[model samples]
Target: IEHSIYQIMKEDSLLYCLPKEPLQQAFRTNKLSVQGTVYGYVGWIFCQHFLERLGKEYLFLIHILDRRNPVGEEVLEKLKKRLHQDTFTREYILDIRKQYPSLLKVLYAHFLTGHYVNQAEASNQPTISYKRLTAMERLPGEDLAKRIKEVTTNYHERLVFEGFLCFNKHVLKTNLYQTTKVALSIRMDPSFLDEIEYPRDPYGLFLVYGSEFRRFHIRFSDVCRGGIRWIRSREREGQSINVR
Candidate 1:
């Protein structure tokens, strides 16, 4: 009976997408909205989700403190606080080393872009496609220890580690909004948002959950960019239409 009970619990543990955070932010912003399957809503998951987790990850903590690496001021102040603790034990080090590859696989899955090509007649909520490659396809289990070392030295690389890094011609013209509330909605670099040549609409993202995972999550999900879903719905350029 004890073995039977253990088997049932182990089955339940295999279920991913167990929710820890709200999957979408209920915000009234024009620039963009963002979401993730696990943590819910975000603009820049890199900072809110990735960096926040990196700070707490034991493997990362151990790597950042190694004397052989160079860390930035942003991370150095964090190191000062971590200095006083008895952070790593022999067992903890060994376990983190073992867990490192699986962790990297999960992290790398979020780096590539998600694009869905379906239409929902309801215009306010056009469903985005988020097909995830089986964990093994996206994550190379090779030299994971060495790859993790890169993140410790430069925290910004965590964003790169998440997906295939590419910017679409659809720049999500964030600056067109008159208020700072709009520009600041996207928490990452706002370099291209300027006073001239507004060419694109602000495209937002929502988390994949429930049926979205089954219906979407294709392994070759990155082949088509998802911008057309937003672009087609808008009034033509040079026309007086502001889509929120």
Candidate 2:
């Protein structure tokens, strides 16, 4: 079956809530990873009830088990019963295992070391680190803008890179000073490399809207440079920055 990423994510949303303790327990004892893991179907059922009683604010979390988790045969049995034969949830977890083997491997390490996976630290690690990868820090305000500019420039120059085109920055104008807004704008391109069959960033222009004196505008620039657009004018008071 052809399943979209959104569909898979919808079925898998509940898996996010599994706690570190049960995960650790299952892994430590070499039990089936899903044993202590919450049932996806149960979570789904509870969410329906919760949505009526509580609202979207309250949600459920579930965890998928692998060999690395501290789950044993008994834990797996309890989960199977709770899942109540929801093939979709089972299939989703199975897909996660196949697609993200590294996640399971990392969980195993956590089980062995009795440590919860540290997302903050792990994300911080540089893609091209010389030494062991360390936690990457949040991109600072200026740093994000600078990175976007760099990416735009590279795309302008037609560099061999991915995600460069999607990178962007918005320059905000305020009474105090000009500020920055960073966001990624990813889209598929029709052009493709003949042999490689890879899509290239298309030629497009950026149109910025908002204030200049107060620095209240979003800056737009092309990922792959060919055309450029600018509107450096301001709108009247109490009115939104016009798009031109």
Candidate 3:
């Protein structure tokens, strides 16, 4: 599992997406925080390779989104064994309901108020709204909230990790934005790309990687005063002619 994931990272240009100067500054200041969601082996593998490349004593925090499931438990055991005696790491394997009550409340209020969504849309960048949150369910806000509440109470639904991550993106940008240098997610929904608006001043980087048929492709975008500018590799078709 580890080897396969490492190969994917290598082939997919994971390191290329990161800006070198900001990364080095992060390491020097010792304020680097790498946060991501882990469902199974692949997520953990990405974390391992990421830390190895960072090449220093850094902190890693991962949320084990599937702690209750059998597969989740299996991976947890393997991860514990692999990361044994690692000092600069912390793992959270709690139920989502108990883990983030305050955050949930804030999200609930956002849904009802739609203040953030309006703000984002007026700025031409939409915040994560009820439409984005229930994109999978295709349900109304009231219904979706009820379903999420059920999951919170019973903890039977399989969307535990997905729900938490979707909701947490808002907090990452607002509450935790200053401290968070880099945030990554694996196999995220394509719609999420539009929702993320990385701050230009503080230099926060968000990377999302997705794989199809064992091959990985990445898209890089940054915000400019005009709009979002896409940075593509020169290897892309019809671009080499202009490389000189």
Candidate that would win on TM-score: 3
Question: Model 1, 1-244: lDDT tens per residue?
Answer: 5433433342233222232323222212311122222211222222222122223454455555664555554465575334312233223233332233334334334332222222223444322222233322343334443455554334334333332122111223221111112111221222322222123422232222221121111122335454212223345632222211
Instruction: List clash counts for every candidate, in order.
Output: 8, 27, 0
Task: Give Cα distance to truth, residue 180, candidate 2, Å.
Answer: 61
Q: Candidate 1 or 2, higher lDDT?
A: 1
| Every candidate's lDDT | 0.29, 0.27, 0.33
lDDT by residue (73-94, candidate 3, tens digit) is 6865656444432422223223
Predicted structure 3, TM vs. truth = 0.20
Pairs clashing within candidate 3: none
Best by lDDT: 3
State every prediction's TM-score relative to the real structure.
Answer: 0.18, 0.16, 0.20
Give the per-residue Cα lDDT of candidate 3 at 216. Answer: 28
The digit string of per-residue lDDT tens for model 2 on 1-244 reads 2223322332233233322222344345544233112222222222221112211222121234343555654565555434333322323333333332232333222222221222223345422111111222234335434544454333312221111111211111111101112211112222321221113432332222121211112123343333224445454621321210
